[model samples]
Target chain A: MKMAWKEIKKSKAKFIILGSIVFLVSLLTFIISGLANGLSMDNAALIKDMPAGQFYMDENAKETYNLSKIDEDTEKHVHKEYPDAAAFSIQMGFVVDGNDDQHSVSFVTSTESDLFENVNDGEIILDRSMQEDGIQVGDKLTNNQYSGEFTVKGFVDQKKYSHTPVAFISMDNYKEMYRTNHMQLLFIPGQDKAETINGLEAFSNTAFLDTIPSYSAEQMSLNMIIWFLVIISGMLFAIFFYMMNVQKIGLYGILKAIGVKTRTLFGMMWSQMLLITAIALVLSVSFSHLFNRVAPDGMPFDLGLETTLQLSGLFIVIGFIGATLSGIQIKRVEPLQAIQQGEM
Target chain B: MTAFTVENVKKTFTNGEIEEQVLNGVNLALKEGEITALVGASGSGKSTLLTIAAGLQHASAGQVMFQGKNLTNMKQEEIRKVRAQDFGFVFQASHLVPFLTVEEQLLLMLDVSEKRMHKQEKKKRITSMLQLVEMEHRKDAYPSSLSGGEKQRVAIARAIIHEPKLLFADEPTASLDSKRSQDVMELIRELTKTLHITTLMVTHDEEMLPYADRIITMKDGLIV
Candidate 1:
């Protein structure tokens, strides 16, 4: 350990370059991961905030939830079989507020269940974010598809879909607007395994989220970028360590010649790798968390502690594996080589 | 008394399908506390024999006996223990660790040799070794800052810090000029006598041969 540290102290510039590269790569991965997670939430907060469960949609809908139409009779049968199950429908529509400005919202209506907000006919409950846009309780709002104006009942928190705030309306209003009495999906909460339903396909909560149009593609692309960055970081670390090892092959030979145990030589390499990686992780974690907190509200960026720790752990593993793999140099060195080389 | 022996050691190197016998069945012994220098021309296998006897490399055939144990039959780890605890080396190049100070270089030697002494005692040993090499004034100097002569002095200090039973010097003065070479050779001779160490040295310089008690000349892989 002491020898390793002394080497680093003597060769500060080489180690500093490697450490800086690690820091930049990790920080970039962290930030992109944060954005991917945040965007996922933005795109599907309503379903994500729900308890773990199974969702059922029409089997012929071809895995597209919006195209799914669960027959009213089948919905009734599911509710009967799973007493706590709820039937719900979602559609994109615009509501005109008192200012006569149109705002897009995911219109939702659900059968009577504790999972959804309840409303009498002609009354509407909206996501609380609508309040920022000047919509208030008892305020009248209109939709071109519905003949009657809705009186805003209240607002719910974090109810969203398709990157838009959700507006909960009566079943009658949803039926009138979409011109369909058939609900799109049936939800049964707290199910470990989804049970098969007649004429419908079963999906877990996460699988159902993927069925949302553009949700999987957007998240998949962003997640791919994050992984690529991680892989590049690992490769970068390995190449740097290999280069450093090649440069020190002669030094290793000399150390071995002086009766240093091969194990001690390995210990020296490990300690150096650990020290460099630790410093880089500390810097990147601090900066990533700092950015997480100060990011503008308009930007969808959320870096949770769990994700940060996962990535940090991954980085350490890769760095360790890389350095250890590069230790072939130490093992391959011949003490006679020390007699060959005149200097370090 | 024979402290170390080399019996009919033959080493063959194969490059592609062509085989070259570097050392061909040669035998010799070194008396305890005596300096035996092997002087030969280039590629005469003097250095090869020295390295084989020091346990730095293995001979393809025959035995290297040190203290009644055949090094050729020992496991790698076992040979390593012998090298660490009983053998020391001074190469043509100083081979001082570039990152370490002169003092630390000696300390590392003590550590590798597994010397069981208190920290203060080890420090004292390092100080004494440095003083013997006339490098005590530059204990804190790095290898890079030292001149060719100074680095060789530090290297000599590191070699004997562990008080090994045998010392192997492979052209230890080759890197220095005439004056520095004489000084370094004098230091090696004096230290081996004081420590009662059996020494095997390989050198091309005829001038340094007089310092050894037994000067064996080699040609074509055999002592002539």
Candidate 2:
């Protein structure tokens, strides 16, 4: 083992070249994995963290809660059963501020003094991202479709959902703007029997989030990108490692001729690859963190420990497979060829 | 006792549809403490015969017995082990592993042996062998940094470091000047006698013939 390590150290140049390639592939894999997780979180962060146990939707609602509607009478019936039901109206739309800068918004409606009364009357609570639009607390904005001005009350930390920033307002204001008294969703706290309440369909919060339009499509698209990166990176690593093994065929022959067993030679080759890959992974992850730290706002780069560990594990598996494929050529090299040459 | 015996060994090569016989019914025996010289022209089967005796190449027919162990019938792995433990080789080109230093090349031979020696013992053996070949001064130098003569000396040291019973040299002095060649042959002969190691050296240089106890000359793959 010591001799094998020494030999690897002596061939530092080749190891460096191989290590650099693996590092680049690992870095790309890490970034892609993070993006995939981040995209999913970005799509469902606000809803996932919302303080709701179950949601009530109309039976006619397709897969999306936005298209679902329950009248005030149905809402009253649900609250009668659950008693902790919070009726809210939600819609996807764009809002223009006093400076005419347009920002996508997910408009939610409830009472100014009840369920969401923390939101002031005739005022909308915007996402923190709206700060980029130069909107202040006293500024007024109008919905593109509703054509009514609303005051900006304050900002919250959570960003967009389905690419739209959330705006909280009173149920009366939301009904007046959309010209409807029906609520899009009823947020109920605690586990309650979700039986048919006045012919309205009630579902768990998990099920409700899945029904959001474009959820599956968004997730699938991001997952495809990540999967493609992993496959391509694995293939590239296998090819590079295989070619490096081919180049070292003569060295293997020499070692065999000198009475080194095939298993020991294999151990040497595997050790070389493992050393290179482990170092590459460490370097790439460190560099990725550096990139994240120096990146400007809204760069869409998110690195988490879970994603990093998962990617590292993936690279190690690929490295082993690649190294095995490369070392397969060892059996074909005859020891005689090392002495006489010209024989493969 | 005979260290190696080759009986009617034959080897042939096929280039496209044309067949060429490289070794034709060659028979030879090397005894325990004798230095035998294999002299022949370039196309003669001297190196081929040495390769067969070393068990590095298989004879197409007939038998090669190293201490009565038939190499022709042995498996490749078995042959490799025998060669590693019982036989040593010196090539025409001083083929030292380029990456290893002089001391490392010698230690590598000891490392591959099935009989495990302690680190201190192995180190002492390597140091003494390097001193024997007068290469202790350059023990840390890589092959690429050494002169042709120096590299050949290192190769000789690597071969004998394990103290094998038989050593085969193929034109060991092929790359050296006349004086260096003489010095190398003398060193090989002196070591063979002192260690009581059987040696078979192939060479086209008749000038080095005086150092050999016996000379077997060949032409057109036939011993003359």
Candidate 3:
């Protein structure tokens, strides 16, 4: 281990170059992963904000939340059985401001419960993002479907569905606008396992999120990019270490001839690898967290501490595997052959 | 006393379908505290025999007896332990670790030999070894900063720092000038006598023969 540290100290330029490349790759990975996570949040913060629970939808809807409508009787039965249960509906529609400018919103309504923002009739609590568009409290917003006006009650943070801001309206307003008395989904919070209802199918939170039309496809592509970056960084370690070991074969051979244990050689290589990776990860994690704070308002980027730690752990493991794979050459080195090859 | 003995040692190399026999039924014994030199042409298998005797490679069909133990019968780990604790080697090139300073090279050797001396004692030994090699002035110098002869001097110091029972020198002076080569040979002779260390060395230079107590000339893998 002392020899390893001495080598790195002696060859500062070489190791620094390796460290810089690792830093760049890992930083890029962190940034892209943050963007993917942020986009995911933007796409489904409405459902994601809910606690872990079971959602029951009509069996005839066939895994499509939009097409599902829980019968009135089943909704009542679930509420009676699970007193904390709530029935909610989401419909994508447009609201025209006083200037007749149309803004797309997911109109959401729920039965009386603490899980949702229960608004008064003809009043709407919109996502705070609508405030940036000049829609203010006490302003009258109109919907063409019901020939009625909605007064803005207040603004809530981070409530979105299908990439659109949410407008929480009363159940009477939702029923009047859509001409429907039945809610689309019945949610029972904090259930370990979803109890089977006769006419309804049960979905866990994750399953219900996947039922959103574009959620999986959108996340799959971003996740692919993030993993590809991670794997590329791993291969980079393998290639870099392979090259370094190849150059030092003669030195390794000479060391072995002098009775240095092969395990000591491996320990040297591993210490160097861990040191380089740890430095790189530290820099990348710091920069990515800083980016999370300073990114443009329009950029969807959300890097958190937990995700950063998980990714850094993966980097260390992958770097170890890569470096160890390259170190197989060290095990194969013969002292006689190195001697025959001349000075290192 | 015979400190080390090799009996009918052989080594063969296989290149594709062709086999080349390098050493054929060679035998030798090294006396304690004496330098025995093996002189031969490039293809005479002297280097192969030296490597085999040093436990750098295995003998195909022979026994290498050191302190009454047959090295050829030992496992790889057992052989490595013997090589670490009982043997020292100096090659044609200096072969000092480039990253290590002169004093550090000797310290590394002590570590490899697993010398469980106190830190102060180890440092004292390293300092004394540096003075013996006349490298104390450049104890902090890396290999890149040292001249060829100086590097070989440090390499020699590294070899003998652990005070092994046997020393193997494979063309240890081949990389030095005439003056430096004589200096290195003198160092080897002085160390072997003062430490009572047995030495087996391979050389092609007839000028260097006088430093050895006995000379074995090989023509075709057989000592004459």
DockQ of predicted model 2: 0.32
Best of the two (2, 3) by TM-score: 3
Q: What is the C-alpha RMSD of each candidate to the true structure, in Å?
A: 2.0, 5.1, 1.6
DockQ of each: 0.71, 0.32, 0.75
Say which docking band candidate 2 falls in: acceptable
Fnat for model 3 comes to 0.71
Q: Rank by TM-score, highest first.
A: 3, 1, 2
Q: Give the candidates in order of lDDT, highest first.
A: 3, 1, 2
Between candidates 1 and 2, the DockQ winner: 1
lDDT by residue (B96-196, candidate 2, tens digit) is 77778899989888877755888899989888998889999999998878998998888888777887888889888988999999989988987888888
Best by TM-score: 3
Taking all chains together, each candidate's TM-score versus the true structure is: 0.95, 0.79, 0.97
Error of 2 at A261 (Å): 2.4
The runs of at least 3 residues in candidate 2 whose Cα sits more than 4 Å from the true structure, single-residue gaps closed, are A1-14, A47-65, A68-90, A94-103, A108-159, A167-247, A342-344, B15-21, B219-224
Which candidate's DockQ is highest? Answer: 3
Name the lDDT of candidate 3: 0.91
What TM-scores result for chain A when each predicted structure is judged separately against the true chain A? 0.93, 0.78, 0.96
1 or 3, greater by DockQ: 3
